[model samples]
Target: MLSRPDVAVVGAGPVGLGIAWRCAARGLRVVVHDPAPGSGASHVAAGMLAPVAEAYFGEHELTGLLTASAARWPAFAAELTAATGADIGYRTEGTLMVGLTADDLAEARRLWAYQQGLGLPVTPLRPSALRDREPALAPRVRGGALAATDHQVDPRRLVPALRTAAERAGATLLPTAVRRLSDVDARVTVVAAGCGAAALTGLPVRPVKGQVLRLRAPGGVPPGFRHVIRGYADGEHVYLVPREDGEVVVGATVEERTDTDVSAGAVLRLLRAAVDLLPELAEYDLVETLAGLRPGTPDNAPILGPLPDRPGVLLATGHHRHGIVLTPVTADLIADLVVTGTPDPLLAPFTPARFLPPNPAGPVGVTGPVGVAELAESADSAGIAGSAATGGSAATAGSASVVRSAAGVAPAVPAVGGRTGPGPSAPEEEHTWN
Candidate 1:
C-alpha cells in the first residue's frame, strides 16, 4: 500500500504524467499510478499538433481549446527540455494539406474555407509553390494549403521526458493499476487513464482503434520532405509526419473496434494513400506497424473538471486524437484547478455532467455523436430541469461522438466518430492530428 498523497493521478500516459509533473512542481504531494506509463495511444500516436488543419464544422469549442493548447506547446517543450535535457523531436516545419486529384482538391477546399473562417491561418498554395517547399511531394498532386501553426513532436520521446520530469519534481510513480476510484487514498484524484477511464468512472470514454506505421529512410538518411503532409489522396485522407532522425510516422485507421490487431486492409490502405501522396515513401523501409486506442468522448472533446457524482475525483481523459497538442494546456489547466479548486471557463464546454442521464427517471442518457451542449437542449425538451445543461455550450450539428448510458452510468466507450478534417465532415479525419 502507498502513503496517501495530496493528489493521486490514475494512468501515466503523457497527459497524466504532465499533470503529475505540474502538480508536483507546485509543491503538492503527487503520486501517479500505472503499470505501463507510456504504452497507450500517446506512444502509438504520430504527434501532429495541428489545430488549424483539424478545425472542422460544429467543433468551435474544441477548436478553441486546441488552439489555446497549441499556443502553450512552445514554452512547454522548452521547459521540459531544459528540465530533462531530452530532445522530444519538437518541430515547427508546419503542415501541408494537399489533394492528389481535382475532386480531392475540391473537398479539401471546403474544409480550408471553414478553417479560414475561424481566423486560422490557412494559406492556399499552388502545386508549384508546394513543391518549392517540399520537392518530394508527388508531382501529380493538384494543389494544397499550408497551416503554418500545425507542428509535430515525437510522442515516443515525449512520454519518457514527462515521466522523468514528474519524478524529478518529487512526484511518486507506482507501477500499480487502479481499477476503482475507492482504491486510491488522496485529497484529489484525477482519472487520466485514457480508454480505461470508462471502466473506472462509468463515463463515455471509448477506445478508438488507430493503426500506425513507422518508416525509416534508406540507409538511415533523413526524409526528403520537411513538412508534415496531410491530404486527401484519391478520397482517402492520410497524414505523413517526418522526423529529424530519418523516421517517418505514417498512420492510422479510426475504427470503432477495440482490438489492437493491425489488419492487412489497414496497412494496404495506409501505404497506398501515403505512396499516392508521396511516391518516395515506397522506397523507405517499412519498419514498425502497430495499433493503439485513443480515448474518445461523447462530444469528441476532452472531459475536464470534477465529476458530479464524485467530488474529489476529476477527469482528464477522452482527448481522442489531439492528445499531444492538447497536453500542455491540459496539464496547466488541470493543475491550476487542483491548486485553486476553481475550474477555468475553457473547461465549461466539456464536462462529465454532460453525459449524465438528462432525466434519471426516464432511461434517457447521453450516447453517440451528440454534443454535451446539445444535452442542455435535450433536457429542455424532456421537461427535466437539471444541470446536464450547465456549463456547456451548443456543439452545432454535424458532430461525431461516442457516448453510452446504462443504469445511469455509461462505461467510458470512445465517442468514436467525432474526428475533424477531411472525408465528409461528420466523422472527419481520425488519423489527422494525433
Candidate 2:
C-alpha cells in the first residue's frame, strides 16, 4: 500500500470535508485529519448563503468571491443531497433585512443604498409590506429590504452530508488533530482547520468568538417563519432562521475573544434582540445556547491558494464568518489547483505567497511548508507522532463526539422528515454580523 495519500487535508470542518469530497470525487487518494469533522465553527454556523445580504463597505472583492460561491449552492446542495440521501434543509425563500426603529430604518436606507449601488437585487418594503411577508415580525418594524437571492442551509445537516459524501468518494477520515505538516510526497496538502490552522500553516488565522442560541416551537406547532429574517433592533443585528421541523435558530453575539464560554449576558442580549424582531419568539422554548470561533483574517477575507515555494501545500483557512457560504467555491478551486497544478484567476488575490517569504527547500523537514517553524519536539515526545510520512493513524483522541445541549441540560432531538436526530447543542455559524 502507498505510504502517503495523493492529498492530506488537515481540518475536517465543512471547508475541509468539502475539499476532501471534491478531491476524492476526482479520483485522488485523500486523507483528512481533524479532532472533529463537522464541529468547530461549522457546527455553530447559521448556514446563511447570503452574498448580497452579507455585503458591506470596501468588500467588493469579497462580494464577488461570495457571490460566485453563492451561485454554486443550488447545484451543490442538490448534488450532495442526491449523493448522501440526506436533506440538508436548504431554504431558498430568501432573506429579509428589517428595521425595528426609526434609527434602524435610517441604517436600512444606507444598506439599501449600498446594495443598489452594487446592482444587487433587493426590494424595498414598507412596514405593512414587511408584516405581509412575515406576519410574526414585531409591529414596531419601520421598513426593510429583501434580498431574494440570499438563502440558508442547516449546517448540522450539511456537515454530516459532506462527511458521508467524502467518505463515499473515498476520502479517509482520520479522527485526530494535525499540529504540524511534513513531506507526504503528495500532490498537495491543505490546511482547512479553522483557528487550528494558525499553528500548522503559520498564517494569521484568528478566532472571532460568537455566542448563538437555538429555539424550538412547542410540539405540534409551527415556527411561523417562511423566510430568513435579518433585522436590526435598537442598533443590534439579529436574525431568525426557521427549520422545517419547527426549530428556529436565533442568534448571535459577536465578541472578540479566544475562550469558548457561553456567557449569560450574551445569551440575554441575543434572545432579547430576537424577540424584539419576532415577538412570538418569546413563547418558544430556548433549547440551546452555544459559542463558536470563526477563523478570521486581519481583513476578514479568506486566505487561499498555494505557497509559492512549497511544492505541495495549500492554505484554505481564514474564512472568518463566511466559511460555510464559501465552502463550495473553496472546495472546487482548491481541488482544481491540487489536481491540475493550475491556479485559477479567482485564487490569485488569496495566494499564500502573499503572507510568507519565499524560500526553496529540497526536502520536508522539522520545519514543513513555507514560513512554518519546526514542530515542537515535546509534541513528538507526547506520542502525537511527527516527521514527513506520518499521517498518524486514526487516533481515538479528539474524535468527533455528539454535540451536547448548550443549556447544560439534555438536548431535545427534533424529528425531521420522520427521523429524530440531535438538536442544536453547541456552536454553529452566524446569520448576522456585529
Candidate 3:
C-alpha cells in the first residue's frame, strides 16, 4: 500500500473539490482538507459566467482564461449534475446589459466600443429589443446590448454538486483546517484555500468582502425575466440574476474590508437599483442577507503552477470574483499540472514566481481597489476590487492610501497631497462594471 495519498489538497471549496474530482477521476489518490468547504465566494457571488463582460482593458491574459473557462462551463455543469444526480441551476438565457438612464447608456457606450474593438460580440440592441428579452425591465430603460454567451449558475447548488461529484470520484474530504504547509504529507500538495492560502504560502492573497441579498418571488413562481441583467440604474453599476425557483440574487456591495457584516446601507442601495430596473422586483420578499469573502491576489489574476522555491507544491487560489465562473478551467489546469508534471502554456502568465524573492521589506504596495463613491440624486453607492493589477476602483483622490467603504455618505476627510480629497465625487468615466 502507498505510504500516503498522492495529493493532499488544502481547501474544500468548489475549486478544491473540483481539482480533487479531476485528479481522482484520473486514478490519483486525493484527500482534501478544510474547516468550512463552501463558506467562500461559492455562497456570495452573483455567479455571472460573463467573459465578454469581464474582458477589461490591460488584462487580456486574464480575459483569455475567463473566456476559455466560460466555454467549458456547459459541459462541466452537465457532467457534475450527471455524476451527482442534482441540479446546479445552470442557465444560458444570456445576459442583458441594459442602461436605465441616458447617462448610464452613454458611459456604457464607450465600454461597448472598447469591447467591440477587441472583437467581442457585444451587439447593440434597441430599447424594444431589451424589453423583448425582459419586459419587466422599467419602461424608461433607454437602450442596451446583448452578451449572448454571458450566462449564470447558482453557486449555492453548485458547491453541493461539486462535493458530491468529488466524493463519488474517490476523493476523501477531511474536516480539518491546514494551518501549516509542513504538516501535509503527500507527493503533491495543492493549496486551493482561497484567502486562507495566503497565510499558508505567504502569497499576497487577501480578503475582499461582498454583501448579497436573496429575494424570493411571491406565489411560488419563477422570476419574470429570462436573461441575467447586468446594468446600471441611475449611474450605479448593479447586476440582477434571477433563478428558475423564483429566487433572485440581488447584490452586492464590494468593500475592501474583511468583516462579513451585512450593512443596511448595502441592502438599501442594491434593492433600490434592482427595483428601479425590474419593477416587479418590488413585490419580491427579501429572504436572506449574507456576506462572504473572495480570495484576491496582488495581480488580480489566479496564481497557478508550482510554488516558487518549493518543490512538490502547487497553487490554485486567488480567484477573486471570478472564482465561481473560473472553477472548471482552474481545476482542469491544476490537475493536468499534477498528473503530467508540466505547466501548461496558459499557466505561464500566472505563476507564483512573478512575485518571487519574498519582499523582505514588507507586504507589497497598494496595487488594489480604492473605495469608489458616486454622486446620485437620491442615493449613493460604494465599492472595491480584489487587486491592483486588474484595474482598481476609480478614485478622484488619486492615492491608494485613501481606502474607505461607501456607506451612503460623503466622507469629510480633508484633501491630501493637494489632490482631490477622499469623498464621493462625480463618477469618473471608466469601465468598472464586471
Q: Worst lDDT window (10 residues) for model 3?
A: 370-379
The local lDDT score (0 to 100) that residue 122 gets in candidate 1 is 98
Give the better candidate number (2 or 3) by lDDT: 3
The C-alpha TM-scores of every prediction are 0.83, 0.81, 0.81
Better of 1 and 3 by TM-score: 1
lDDT of 2 by residue, 35-111 (tens): 66777988888889999888998888788889988999999999999999999999999999988899988998898
Cα lDDT tens digits for candidate 3, 350-411: 77766665434433222211111111110121111111111111122232233221111111
Candidate 3 stretches greater than 4 Å from native: 358-434
Q: Which pairs clash inside model 3? A: 367-388
Determine which window of 10 residues in candidate 1 has minimal summed lDDT: 424-433
C-alpha RMSD (angstroms) for model 1: 12.1
**Clashes found in each candidate (C-alpha, N, C closer than 3 A):** 10, 8, 1
Candidate 1, position 258, lDDT: 91
What is the per-residue lDDT of model 1 for residues 1-434, given as tens digits with 9 covering 90 to 100? 55447678998999999999987776667899998889999989999999999898999999999999999899899999998999999999999999999999999999999999999999999999999999999988999999999999999999999999999978999998876676677666888998988877778898899999999999988898999999999898899999988999998799998999999999999999999999999999999999999999878999986665354567899999999998998888777665444455677687677787554563223222222232233234444222221111222221212222222222121121332222112221111111
Model 2 pairs whose backbones collide: 43-427, 43-428, 44-427, 44-428, 44-429, 45-428, 45-429, 46-429
Q: Would you give me the overall lDDT of model 2?
A: 0.73
Show where candidate 2 strays beyond 4 Å: 183-185, 357-434
